[model samples]
Target: MILYTPLAETDIFPVSEADLQKRHCVSHNGKQLYVEEMEDGQFQLLQVLSTDPNDFMNTDYIPGTILR
Candidate 1:
């Protein structure tokens, strides 16, 4: 099992326009999340995680990382 911890405040650390164009997500938890690109040229985060019953805001998801 993997765990992710995300930011608490959107005011300080926000996803920039450039990052929105470059988020290539890897599959997780036997399911793949699909994030779409909006007509305004910004990538929308997958609501799948945000709508989780435990964490409704999905603010606590940071992909696991391997440190070697």
Candidate 2:
């Protein structure tokens, strides 16, 4: 799984499987963030800010890499 620190002015890191299971991270704005790797090697960001979870759920998965 890939891990990104959007607030950090550095490149993103590819998380090790062991670290992904053990490490916890918080965002710069103090929100708790969790990363999970999908079976397809894509990563997901959890606990994101959104006005509607249902709308988000209805939307198609946009394919793109996160830039650091």
Candidate 3:
């Protein structure tokens, strides 16, 4: 696993590099998909996404300092 600092010149995400720039963390239960805010003010899904990619960013972040 690659660990990137928030201040890193590169952007890091919970999922694969392809799925990095995502804002919603999607979790599926059968036919239902649950997507939550990524990097919410409270880091809501950080804990969840950190462990599983099932609910991960759907968008990509630009390489630099990302506030979220």
What is the clash count for each candidate, in the order shown?
Answer: 0, 0, 5
Residue 44 local lDDT, model 2: 60
Deviation in angstroms for 12 in model 2?
32
60 Cα displacement, candidate 3 (Å) = 6.1
lDDT (Cα, tens digit) per residue for candidate 3, span 20-62: 5454454433212323344444222332323435334433321
How much is the lDDT of residue 18 in candidate 1? 76
Q: Which residue ranges in model 1 land beyond 4 Å of their true spot? A: 1-11, 24-30, 34-62, 66-68
Local error of candidate 1 at residue 9 (angstroms): 5.2
Per-prediction TM-score: 0.27, 0.24, 0.16
Candidates in order: C-alpha RMSD to true structure? 10.8, 13.1, 12.4
Which is the leading candidate under TM-score?
A: 1
- Worst ten-residue run, lDDT, model 1? 59-68
What order do candidates take by lDDT, descending? 1, 2, 3
Q: Write the per-residue lDDT of candidate 1 for residues 1-68, one digit (tens) a residue.
A: 54445754335468888756655443445334445455565444454443446544344333332211
Count of backbone collisions in candidate 1: 0
Residue-by-residue lDDT tens digits, candidate 2, 1-68: 56655653223446567755743344423433444445565456543444655534633322232212
Using lDDT as the yardstick, the better of models 1 and 3 is 1
